[model samples]
Target chain A: MAEIARLAGVDTSTVSRALAGSPRVTKETRALIDKIVHETGYVVNETARHLRGGRANQILVIVSDIAAPFYSDVVQGIVETLAERGINVLLGVTLRQAKREAQLAKQLLTGVVDGIITVTGSIPKPVLSMPGFERKVLAISRAVPHEGVTCVTIDNCAATRQVMQHLHQRGHRRIVYIGGPNYSETYRDRRGAYADFMRENGLAELARMRATDSFNDDADSGFHIMKSILNEGDRPTAVFCATDELAIGAMAAARQADQIIPRDISFFGFDDLKLTPLMSPPLSTVSVPRFEMGRRGAEALFRQVYKDAPSSSKVVLDHRLILRDSVATIV
Target chain B: MAEIARLAGVDTSTVSRALAGSPRVTKETRALIDKIVHETGYVVNETARHLRGGRANQILVIVSDIAAPFYSDVVQGIVETLAERGINVLLGVTLRQAKREAQLAKQLLTGVVDGIITVTGSIPKPVLSMPGFERKVLAISRAVPHEGVTCVTIDNCAATRQVMQHLHQRGHRRIVYIGGPNYSETYRDRRGAYADFMRENGLAELARMRATDSFNDDADSGFHIMKSILNEGDRPTAVFCATDELAIGAMAAARQADQIIPRDISFFGFDDLKLTPLMSPPLSTVSVPRFEMGRRGAEALFRQVYKDAPSSSKVVLDHRLILRDSVATIV
Candidate 1:
């Protein structure tokens, strides 16, 4: 650091900041410092510099599956935010594979990133036990047992409870809950909330007909899940899905079976995506704070990456229930 | 390189392969080579290495928008293919913003990536004229007038004509065509096909009902566009949309207006997305070989990047039309 500073005729701090691509330094001076480093074959050891400066320019993001549409927006938000700060982001998708998750954790032993943000629940304790993870990891949309790992997510249980409450208020006693695979954090949150809300409201009889988690948010999957329920010949008056895609699928199946939405049966969905409103009977859904989640998640990572400041233990955002034409009063 | 080989008591080529993280190299040798490089402050100049090997390990991919769902599969294919060859991918999304597109072109000027693949239309000729024109470059889903630029796309014009023939065979005369914005190569192909098909078939009167370019594949956008046509007291017995999202929206609008599918009006869509089958009345549309297109596009870029082959001028893939419940014979 002192050698570069002496060669560039600047203070060691200015040299450090310039090399770090800090905007506070004049562009011309930064260029001069960069040129000197290039000419002299001088390369700053990023790991060592990070240790000395107590800050890092890297953020790690772990997602359950990169292919899933639900995570795309959230990942975009984090990437855009961190990119602005000149911080590099390392993304890992577990694909909901436990072995892959373990491998991803082992890979993180490279210690390339300063902090970690995970959207998956199954974070292995062995990875966090690494010496570098004292204060640099946060989880989003999932919970971690480690007190060191803070989380940013919506109140999934509360939101699903509200969905049940809304359905009840609309005079729907017989309501079906369409859930995804058991491994997902969202499935657990929503299912737990549904059971609690139903029991508390004395609607346990209505909760007896639960659709198994097989289908994703796609219509084909939703159709089959809805079909099995309808095939039982004990039709629910309304259906609540863990995700909007599932709701759409179920709606298609109902229509195919000649059951009308909001007329013969009502539907409620989660994560009100752009396509939700375009459905024939505009779907009613809980709008996950997608844009905000993106903004906050990224902002949180950047704060740690740049300022070396510890983040809030947990950051919870608000989710809104959007009432559309999919639900109706069962007079 | 010779120093590492001497230290490890191995051949220079063995040392080089180990340092490059080649799986062919023994794990012990690879680790030893990495340690030697770290200890000696050795930096591998990628450009110089590529110059000797006649191949580069980096690829640049430019797309119109990353937020859309269509490109995810394409990216996934490219990533998978590149990961196998130990090549790194630099993804750039233009977001339909011209400045960002130009900026991305500038980034390519530094020769950071060995080859380029673009889904965006005509890169300003000046941008392509940049210094590193000798490496590989392919355009996906677009045609550009560059000597070395290869184009990989579906035969859009033929595909459109096929759809029209299907509707015609179903005995539909009053058919309206929905197209995309004028800026894209895709719109040009489909629109040109529509014009020629109508003229040849003596359906010139019906061709005038082409929907405005602003109607992107959104449900509301399609709904409003369809509503305007219906409000004008001019209704097409059949509608052919350029994209499936638009067709879904148009169908939603027709339903909102109390029009029955096939019974009152029939619809056809392009791009047989997964949702098409799940639609209330499954959409009848043409299916683009999406996974194949993605695979071919990546393979083309990789071949050019590694072989320095004169970009094969163009590659066109096959497409098929799917018949579903959305269209019916004019009864």
Candidate 2:
């Protein structure tokens, strides 16, 4: 180790940490040290190194789906922030399967990753209650209510209210909400708020659809749901989706129906993904700071990995409604 | 080892490999064994285990960008197939940075990853010449022409030809090609094919744009490129891009310019990403089997990992032209 330190121009501890593959050693230092180690034909026993250092400098991030751009920006933020801190990320996309989530949670015990940041919440409680879970897990986007568990999420109810208020002010009396699977806390936040707002405003919530498939982020599934809604007549004057994919799918259906947006009906969505801005009418949406949330969420995980702190606080970020051409202000 | 195998209901080699975290052991068997090990408080020294097995079931995949759905679907396919084989994946997103690519390639020498599947080319040759590079490296999408190297790609020339054929038959005499960075092999394949097709038909190949910010899959950048092309006064009758993201961006630009697609100008793109179908005009594109390609590429990697076979086979998949509302035949 001392010899490697001298050869690589890094300290002895950095040589050890780099050998351990811990996030504490930056990639450049690791590369320089690895190059020297290879030239000298030095072999590193990673497990032993990890055991001594107690960190592999690697963190695990579990998402519902990677193909969804909604999650991609979040991942982009996490990777960028972690990389700067000499931490590497190992990502898993659960595809909304609780079994897969459990399987990944099980893999956590192997200790290849020092900490975890999970965007999906269906992770079983038994898995979460395991001795090592509480200290290492940080939930983002989907809030987990296990006391002392740190969660970073935007104000779901507040954002939902803003969408409702926007549509209400536009004079749309019949409004329907398209939500995700009922299992998600984020869904609960949005759906409960949607229902409560409707009740308070004397408008009935008649058109809420869930579980055509568990896929909440895919446009393919979203298209099917929207097609069903449009096919069944007596359609609501306005529709608000839990996420952008649903709204985009609904828009495609509307176009197929030859109904002009803002002329025939109003539509709104959440997340405000990059593609939403490029949609034909430029979707009206509630914008969540995806990249910023990801950066902050990863930073929270690092606080645990670096300072060894056990933080179980709930952090609520802000959201705002972005009114675009999709919403029809009924005159 | 024999006793552990009997207890885990598997063979001795399976026990050894599972203990070593080798892809050879199925995840279920590994999980069952891990559970048993934890229940029995059995201590397996992972370093010694790896030394005995001589392999890690983990393979590394290097991608150009993780945020793009084009790459995500490819990753999804690779991960799903590899996981079925009890293999774990370590993914790296280069974000089109040459320095980052160099860093990851350097880490390959540390031998933590058993094999590599690089979705992007531009890997430095000096790094490829290092010992242990040949058998374990497989290039997907972007072709690497190093001798005795395996590459998995769809028929780029055929796909490009089909796009040209579609536009030509649709009465588009003036067509523009929106290509990726000139350094990309896939770009070369598609661009060369486009130019050759035009030359063969005696159509002027005067509308090729490259190196405007060097962005390959960003709509924001694509919008700027398209705006410039539209502002140049002699806009092509049709615009074909290397990827859907570019097409979507061009559409946004066209919208801002108050020019309707296919009415004012036709549009076409490649990859037929999921978002393409939901776009305003339902983007016309060439459909490449992204998920299947990913699966086959990973499977090719596993054959080498499991059998230690020095396979350098070039496998080309098929692509088809998808006609959508974005293209309008002149009356």
DockQ of each: 0.19, 0.42
DockQ of 2: 0.42
TM-score of 2: 0.87
**In candidate 1, which residue ranges exceed 4 Å CA deviation?**
A1-67, A86-94, A98-117, A122-129, A134-138, A209-217, B1-58, B110-113, B122-127, B209-217, B307-310
How would you class the docking of model 2?
Answer: acceptable
| lDDT per residue (tens digit) for residues A209-290 in model 2 | 4443664546666677777878888877888888898888877888888888868878898999887888888999999998
Residues B1-331, model 1: lDDT tens digits: 6777787788989877887667898888888878887776454543445446544455666766444555655655565566556565555655566666665564345344566777676673435555556346677777776766778789999999999999899898888877667667787788888878888999987775455555254555777788887787778899888888778888888888899997788999887876778886889999886656767878877776675566777799888989999888875
List the lowest-lDDT window of 10 residues for candidate 2 chain A: A207-216
Ten-residue stretch with the least lDDT total in model 1 chain A: A104-113
In terms of lDDT, model 1 sits at 0.73
| Candidate 2 collision pairs | A21-A56, A22-A56, A22-A57, A23-A57, A148-A312, B22-B57, B23-B57
lDDT of 1 by residue, A246-266 (tens): 888899989988998889999
Cα displacement (Å) at residue A134, model 1: 6.5
Q: Provide the RMSD of all predictions against the true structure, rounded to 1 decimal.
A: 6.2, 5.6
Which predicted model would earn the best TM-score?
2
